[model samples]
Target: MKTIFFSFLFFGSLISAQNSLSFQAQLPSINLWTKIPDGPGPGGENIVSAKGSVTHVSIPKLIIHQPENPNGIAVLVISGGGYAHIESGSEGYPASEWLKSLGITAFELQYRLPEEGWATRSVPFQDAQRALRIIRKAAGKYKIDPNKIGVLGFSAGGHLAGYISSTFNTAYYKPQDDIDLISAQPNFTAMIYPVVSMLPPNNTTHSFKSLLGKDSDEKDQAKLSVEKQVNAQTPVTFLAQSEDDPISPVENSILMYQALKDHKIPAELHLFQSGGHGWGMGKKGTNTGEWTDLFLKWLKVNGIYNSDQ
Candidate 1:
């Protein structure tokens, strides 16, 4: 019996290694759809006619940098391109590589967009939830610790990540296969220039309307604003934004941080005076790029970086 167990373990390890190698090779070729466009935008007061989709899909590219020592920390990275496209190079790859260098496994999620239907809010959210479950289901194979999983997103992706963190308990779609058994809650979240407010004062951020749909009325708006839904159970969040960001204002992160604090959830807000929006990983010598270092330190202070556990 002992010999059979040992043989199984050895074979499993070999198989996992082979699979990882194959995945690495194929990562470059994986073309995941950000969203399938529905038609033109929904022109109206406060609502802008933007590209949208019905069935948004995500293709996660897993990169393992520090393969020798797995830190148990896994980050699901979401890139920002409003709700129209995904900035893969600037936001996705660079951010993932940074996490990988820190011994943390990274999964770059190319979530669905809002170009399909105006009334559909479930697509992108569902994709995020599915991605989390898929990662957790294959945690052992990926050499990732299931409990230490977290999420990071930029711009619209930031909203997606925040939504996932808040709505882990809300089931929008049926589970697929056994992977559905895992919870979708992100242990922690890091949002960069996220769009947290969608109502009147933040009408300029049409990304929310594009995602949720044009018909998303006041009630729906109230429901989707993650800042309003934050609770004690909300994951610890680290947020950063520039004051001069034209796409997403600094108030977005500020509102989220305030909500988190109100709920007594551990939260950190780093508002840089410069570094206008969409500077993924930031340019060299810029304050935005410095956010990564600050995030790492915050993680350490919060005890999330402890590898011993």
Candidate 2:
């Protein structure tokens, strides 16, 4: 029974919008079934890459980015690291910065890696669900609409976002407090080149192995294949992937979009000709750079964002 305490992150690079890291705190009172796992995983104990990704995480934290003119919209941004690490540097921070500029309050989630060692497969899922409820519980404090909360994830994180978006009704963990009473569901979801499936050739082996472990059964994998889990209550979704994505096949996004449509949920998909994958917010001359603009428009069209607000 090891308890984790809050340790605020104050790095300028990790903060979005001119040092606007309004809040960076651990999800309060997490009750994992077992003690939190310490890292000695792929990149060695808690070593962060030059690219800003950390190879190990014992405690998950939520970094808040407040917009200069908040339009009552919020997004929980999850970065991808193939379930091996947390890609806060590339995927998380940059996306939060962009979201902040657009007046959308962003919360960057640094979640635990299952492969690093956790008692259960649902550890990261629990972190995400708790993070959303925490935000919703304090919706008035952030001056954002609770019902407008959405999630945006990249790569493996996209799989996580898709997971919670579709299966939020499932209780992955016991309630810690009144915050747990708030809905963990996202109003919308945006998955960028995500690893959506856990079955067959389309599944990314690294993510599958990290999530379900090497000796995982077919039944367990089938249950986590997000496309197979979509129901009538799945949130409106937006998916973007490069046609030539080498890691997560483009079919991942396609399958998710089809599931959403099958359930009569509003959905959108964008396929780029180039840009091989993990392009984060994209650089100068890539088609993936245009995804943010497209996403903003979709949010507005879906009534999740209001320029007037």
Candidate 3:
């Protein structure tokens, strides 16, 4: 295992009080391409919201949030935006903050938008896979257990987390460095209101169109759907969603849970009576708001986390 010590000064402009590192800035470079690879047509990234929702991302980044008391566990956080943009503020940052309370290090992913002009629709997957490898490769530096790294994603980002968890063995991009040699497979996965299927009754049209393109065929949809892609190697998973979620239907989570169980993968599902969708970290007064506690308990029960450590 190689140890990497980053010079935070070089990224002074990019780093806030919290650390932010671009994929392009990795020490040995685990970037997918030499530059932002072009897509079928013309376009560029843009920030669209005060909450830091962005589209057409050219520089995929990881925002690091370290706990004051390290517990040797880490989680890669991916926010959802239906593949159109990243909901970093609502999902990513808050998730990281919550994880920090447990002494778990968090790396919030600002992944590329497939809706942008990427050379392939798999660009987001490539970024996600690379991010996991980077986290594992830097385990020593971050004081994290390489084997304890997991992923938490919301909505479309949940689909992405599911994709990476189920398909980690598949190379989404050519190896770029030694980091690529590290396993991209997450130790476990947690998805909230994920867009799991591309077929009817559960298909999230916006996320589907953003990822597979407007002209994507049914075959393409079926092939890449996260639920359909689950295998024996898929990571143990924890899924939570609301029965009343108007956006990405509740059936999406059900389909994924079913697939995991069929493959004999250890999985947990939490269904809320209400809470709708996109309630990142959830609201404070509702039962859904207690999901963080539920997740922590689940982690301990699964032996994936040990607070006593």
Candidate 4:
């Protein structure tokens, strides 16, 4: 296993003290694509959204969110933008805050979009694996337990969390550094309104198309449809989605839950009536508002809640 050593400042540190600590690096073995452009995001209140979301990703950024009392648990947070843009505001910063409140550190991952002339589908996954290696390798310095590293993904990011958890053994790129020697498997995963399948008849077309390309063959599509990829080794999972999610169907979570059960992996699923798709944490009067509550309960059961700290 390649062991790459690096450091990033903890979140909440003074701006002057932390600026130099930000860690943004390209994945190991970025062979051909050297130059990438940084495009503007669809700016909003506290959120950054890249219009069309297909811009090239030069480097993956890991923005840390450190907890006041570290309990050895950490989460790699991934935001969704339908494979085009990243929902950093809605999913990244807010997610880190929540995770911190639970005494768990969070690293917001700014991953590559497939449209940037990358593999069109594989770049995101490859980057994700690399991100896992970086976080796990630096866990000790970050006051985290390498074994407690988990993934929490929103929407398209959710699909990535599931995919990486299920397929960490498959090598998409050659080893780059010492970090490559570490396992990329997340100890646990939480997928929110994720895209579980890439195959036709149940696929989130826009996401799949952006990922696999419109001209890609069905066989390739089937290979990435994560629900079918689950094996006995997939980690325990937590999933939540509204039944009325207009974009990705609720069936995505259902199919995944069933697969986990078949494999005898610990799993939990929550479906809400309101909070249409992409609501993040739901607004007032939505049953989905309690999704995190359910998640924390499950986490406690699985010994990930970190109440001892």
- Give residue 84's error in model 3 in angstroms: 0.4
Q: Which stretches of candidate 3 lie over 4 Å from their true place?
A: 1-48
lDDT of 4: 0.73
- In the range 1-309, model 2's lDDT, one tens digit per residue, is 011000112232444333222223322223322423333323433445665676666656677778777888889999998888777766787687678877888888878788665667677898898888877877898889988999999999999999999889898887766777889999999999999999987655578988877776778889989999999889999999999999999999999998888889999999999889887876334577777778888998998877675
Regions of model 1 farther than 4 Å from truth:
1-68, 117-119, 307-309
Please give, for residues 140-235, the per-residue lDDT of candidate 4 as tens digits.
887888889999998999999999999998896777667788899999999999988887676655688777766768888888888899999899
- Assess every candidate by TM-score: 0.79, 0.85, 0.86, 0.82
lDDT of each: 0.70, 0.78, 0.78, 0.73
Error of 1 at 181 (Å): 1.4
- Which residue ranges in model 2 land beyond 4 Å of their true spot? 1-47
Per-residue lDDT of 82-171 in model 3, one digit per residue for the tens? 888887656776677668767999988878877666677787898899899989988998899988999999999999999999889897
For candidate 3, give the lDDT: 0.78
**How well does model 1 score by local distance difference test?**
0.70
lDDT of 1 by residue, 96-125 (tens): 766776788788775555574334546677
